[model samples]
Target: MQETRVAVAGTSFPAVRQHLEEMLPGAVVEAVPVELLRSGGCAAEVLVPAMCRIDAAVIDRVDGLRLIHQWGAGLDGVDIEAASRRGVLVANVPAGVGGNAESVAEWCVMAAIAVNRRLPVLQRVLRSGAAWGDPPGRSLHGRTAGIVGLGGIGQALALRLRPFGMRVLGVRRREDAELAGRLGLAWIGGAAQLPELLRQSDCLFLCLPLTEATRRLIDERALALLPAGACVVNAGRGGVVDQAALVRALESGRLGGAALDVFEQEPLDPASPLADRPDVLATPHIAGVTDSSYRGIARRVIENIHRLHDGRPLLDCVNADPAGAQASRDS
Candidate 1:
């Protein structure tokens, strides 16, 4: 039997290596650095890409690559079409199993409350030794929260918000009447109802994925629908919301404030206007990245590898190609 080989691209993260080693007892798990991956030095049966570019050029060099298992949920960085053309199966750790949905949910709710309460302005006032009563912060109690994309993170957020005495509204691909009743969503509808949902929301949470249809989904028209002074919290792909339009809305006071964990261009340009705004809270993209989440990701990778080696079906195969997975069966 040929010993299985796996290569990971990123700064050396020991936990992932340890888990991969334990799962594939005698197999080799090489921690390839970004420079090497970009230079086409990694040649392994399986590739684990963690926040590294896996473009078509990089894919062309991996001679016998059978799988491109993502270390996290986001596949935006990967060249899925390139991998598909080469018959390489691409997979990711879905929400419930990875435990990241809960972490993201907490971050979303926290941002919503933090921005609405005007934390920065209040802190600045007290630090400057000025009286604090002039700027008031709003409470989540009795307010309506509109959540777009009722996926794992959205469902988790809806559940978490109930205790705060807020009404939850959701929009997704289809209206799940049953899920709406169980999740206690005040109302659930499809994309057409988004305008109404925005109009009613005091806090709007964008948790949708970035697709061709969803890119810039929340632009000037959508922001204009938001009730004046409404707070926006985005834990989803930044491209989903029009960053330029958002800035204009905030500048004009049409939208109250925003808490953003991800931006259209990451390491968000220092010169950007949103960086220093008191109403905007911008954090590096670390919403779902936690120690626990890393471990969960390792487990998902292990499970998929086992399935691939044993000729069983892989989980969360986004680009479901029979030939890609069947190659592993033949191996």
Candidate 2:
């Protein structure tokens, strides 16, 4: 029996390695860094990484590349159009609720509370032993929350926000979302409903994917629609929000503040304006990492591979083609 030959485009942490070992007992695994990938000298049939940008030139360089698997759900880094032309299969593991929903919701919720209650302002006053911080604050109860992209994460947010007694307005594909009705989401009319949602929402949470349609969905016009002192919470792709626009909104007091877990540029530079803003709270995109989420990630990746290897249906296939590379016999 010939074992499957595989390669890793490197991973962020060790749990990915352990899961890969458990999933593929005899397959060869090489954790090559991005520089090695750029060199175009290494040999591998599969490449998995947290973020790997595979363009037409890189695809040309990969002599015998078959599949590129993104460790997480987003595939913005991979050139899907070029990959489709080249017949290279790409996969993303967004199958069974990528554990990001709850964690990201938590961050957004915390941000809303922190900003509404002026927690950061109070902290500064406390440190200086100043008298009576008098920043106006709002309560979550009876407030409106606009959740964009009512997918896994958005649905989870709706569920979580319900306990707060807040009214939730959802904008999604507008197709029949069976789960949306089941979850009791008050469906907004259309994407055009965006302005109305922003106008009414005390906190606007973005849970959308970054597509051509959704990129910078919250631009100047969108930000201008928000009620005064409203907060913006982005847990999805950072490209969904225009960074410059957000900063301007914050500076102009058009928005009270923003809580961000992901960014347009990751591992944000200390010198970045967003980092320096006392009003903004930012996290380094760790909203979906925990021992449990790791296990969930492992299970989804392994199951998909199992389906592919055993002539079964591929679960959570992100790439246009799943078998564009090398197809193996059933195990």
| Maximum-lDDT candidate | 1
Query: For residues 175-228, could you state the per-residue lDDT of candidate 1 as single tens digits?
Result: 788999999999899988999999999999998877888899999999999999
Candidate 2: C-alpha RMSD to true structure equals: 3.4
lDDT of 2 at 307: 60
Best by TM-score: 1
Per-residue alpha-carbon lDDT of model 2 for 65-160, expressed as tens digits? 656676667788888778767766677777235575666666677777877777767777778877874666778899889998877777777888
lDDT of each: 0.85, 0.74
Stretches of candidate 1 exceeding 4 Å from the true structure? 1-5, 12-35, 123-134, 321-330
Q: Which TM-score value belongs to model 1? A: 0.88
